[model samples]
Target: MSSATQRRVFLVAALLVAAVALGVISMGGIGENLVYFWTPAQVHENASKAVGATIRMGGVVQADSVDWQPDTQALTFTVGESAVDTATPITVHAQSAPPQMFREGIGVVVEGTMTDAGTFRADKVMVKHSNEYRAPTDGMAPADLYATVEEL
Candidate 1:
């Protein structure tokens, strides 16, 4: 083969190797940052694989399971499936203050990792609000639902 042709072939091969290396490096970074979403039941079912990995756990807050300590800004709650009998509840502990909308029976997605001791330690808690909107059902006008401005 001509020298020119040999040089061109070498350049192409070098470019291909560089491209493959870049792709692999990018994929490694993405894999480390990737967080998987799972329901409380799913997490429980796959507890062995989920422990020590960051995940997003979604479920309804169990009634009477929330315990907040303002002095320490510690919040602990249990998340369970909508159908209580279907799956066991998962307890979550978060050091941050609970969101203003946090309440029992509401859906929540907590981002954290499950400990070996069988509890989830959350760094961020997001309240999942319903998409459905409804007007006041008490036969009162929308304006009546809001207290007088003077009350504020």
Candidate 2:
């Protein structure tokens, strides 16, 4: 092959190697920073691998499972599937006051790591709102729906 052709081939090969190296390094960083999103059921299924790994757990808060102490700002709650009784719930503990919209049966996503004791130590809690809006049903006025807001 001509010297010019050989030089071009070597340059192309070097560029390819550099591109591959950069891709691999970026992928490694992404893998380390990735936080998996899991439901309560999935978390239970992957309990062994999930322990101590940062994750985001999302599900509906179980009714009557929220316990918030104002004095200590400790909040503990259980998250489960749409039907709380259908699957085992994951316990989540956070050291901050929950959002005002936080309530039983609401969808929530907590970001944190799972403790060895199987509890999720949440550093951030986010309330998930429904995208679909429904009008008041029969016998319920629009004003009735706003009663809770009025009380607040």
Candidate 3:
């Protein structure tokens, strides 16, 4: 081959190898950086895949499901939609106190790694929306709802 062509080929090969190496390194960190979130149903469906994986499970808090031990500050509760098919629910165990917004029927995202025992040891808990948006029902005039937004 011509010297010019050979040089071009070597440069292209080196670039390709560098790209692959970069891709592998990035892939290794991707799992740790990614926060996988799923509903109760989704968790059940992908239970095997989620095993031992760190992820964020998003769901509504089940009403009257919280049982807190005052001395230990240990809490047990159901986190997910009530209509979930799987009987297996996420049991969150935190060493410290839970967030203020952590309550029954409120949306939450628990960040932790799942154990083979199905318990999630959460290091952080983020309060998400409850998906309960309601308009004023007290017979307010139609002008009231949009009054603030319209003025802005």
Candidate 4:
């Protein structure tokens, strides 16, 4: 082959290799940062896959299963798929204090990993609440919901 043609081939090959390397490096970074979100039922279903990885389980805190020990700063609760879901519930233990809005029948997203004991160990507990703001209906008018200079 001509020297010019050989140089062109070498340049094309290097570009291809650099592109593949860049793609692989980017994917590794993205995968490492990704934390999967699943429900209690999904966690059970994917037990083998969910173990020992940082997972965020989204579910409702079971009313009767909540046990908060302020003395120990440990909160344990069972999360179900939903308030009425009776089929599946997963126990979650958080060493940190529960959020102010964390309560029975409330939607929560617990970020942690599944243990061999079949319980989730949460490092962070996030309470899910409505984004839409609704004014109080207890004798409060629409204007009462907003702040005004007169009221201040």
Candidate 5:
């Protein structure tokens, strides 16, 4: 090929390589920012590795285990199945209010990192609803946000 043609080809090849490299770099950042999910059993099994690691957990809201301090908007609860053979129970604590669908017998997904105290300090709370059923009127105010439960 002529000198001019060769120069143009080289420039094109270099630009293609540079673009590929830039795309890879940007993707790497996105992958690192992505969080993971874990179930209550898995969290307990891998407590050390899960410490300070952001993850999501799913389980049914334990009956009568829910507690809320209306004055401070603080809440604490235990979630799990009634059968011991199922996933282990987990405790969650949060300063903010939970989603509107959250209630007794409903499943939930709590997103946050585990602390040394063994409490999951939830940054986000999700509710699990069955399609066949709808919540009845309880004469209570609804929450600000709602999220579907996602299994870890």
Candidate 6:
């Protein structure tokens, strides 16, 4: 008895399979794989869709614009917006080997891609200390491996 044009083609194929299963369930929802660390004024306000994509900026490290050349391990710098204020800066350019708490104004994140002559060509630098676990007021537990504070 399925008359009326086969029940309107089975209700338009069940509303077109519920709109393609809600567009693939909103593409696996919930930020899919959240990992944003852009700063330095959000990478100069997304500098034209962030040059070539791969981002993760972050800031502070522009004191004398460090130029670590540990025998050519190469690692230029210049990522301000704090550390007494160097305003908007962003000249990363890393090649590797520079960690050991890296110095000058600290706080970095780097990651990569943004050249076109604007610099920030890192591959991955990340050096933002403070995991917090200070249980050594110096009674005899001296283990200060690269411990730094430079000023609270």
After aligning candidate 4 to the native by TM-score, how far in Å is the CA of 40 from where it should be?
Answer: 0.9
Question: Which ten contiguous residues of candidate 2 have the minimum total lDDT?
Answer: 27-36
RMSD of each: 7.5, 6.8, 8.5, 7.6, 8.4, 13.4
Clashing pairs in 6: none
When summed lDDT is taken over every stretch of 10 residues in candidate 6, the lowest stretch is: 143-152
Give the TM-score (vs. native) of candidate 1: 0.65
Candidates 1 and 2, the one with greater lDDT: 2
Poorly placed runs, candidate 1 (over 4 Å) = 1-36, 83-86, 136-152
Question: Which of the predicted structures, 1 or 5, would earn the higher lDDT when compared with the native?
Answer: 1
In order, how many clashes per candidate?
0, 0, 0, 0, 0, 0
Residues 72-139, model 2: lDDT tens digits: 99999999977465557888999998886899999999999889998999999999999978777799
Better of 4 and 6 by TM-score: 4
Residue 84 lDDT in candidate 1: 57
1-152 per-residue lDDT for model 4 (tens digits): 99999999999999999999999877767655564578888898889988899889999988789999999999999999988678889899999978867889999999999999999999999999978677577787767446532443
- TM-score of candidate 6 versus the correct structure, residues matched by position: 0.28
- Of the two candidates 3 and 6, the one with more favorable lDDT, higher being better, is 6
Model 5 alpha-carbon miss at residue 44, Å: 0.7
Report the lDDT tens digits of candidate 1 across residue range 1-152.
Answer: 99999999999999999999999878767654564578888898889987888888999899888999999999999998872524578999999988877889999999999999999999999999899887768877767546543344
Query: TM-score per candidate, in order?
Result: 0.65, 0.64, 0.55, 0.65, 0.60, 0.28
* Comparing 1 and 5 on TM-score, the stronger one: 1
Q: Report, for every candidate in turn, its global Cα lDDT versus the true structure.
A: 0.86, 0.87, 0.73, 0.87, 0.76, 0.79
Residue runs of model 6 more than 4 Å from their true location after superposition: 1-28, 37-51, 57-68, 71-73, 76-108, 114-120, 137-152
TM-score of 5: 0.60
Query: Model 2 residue 147 lDDT?
Result: 78
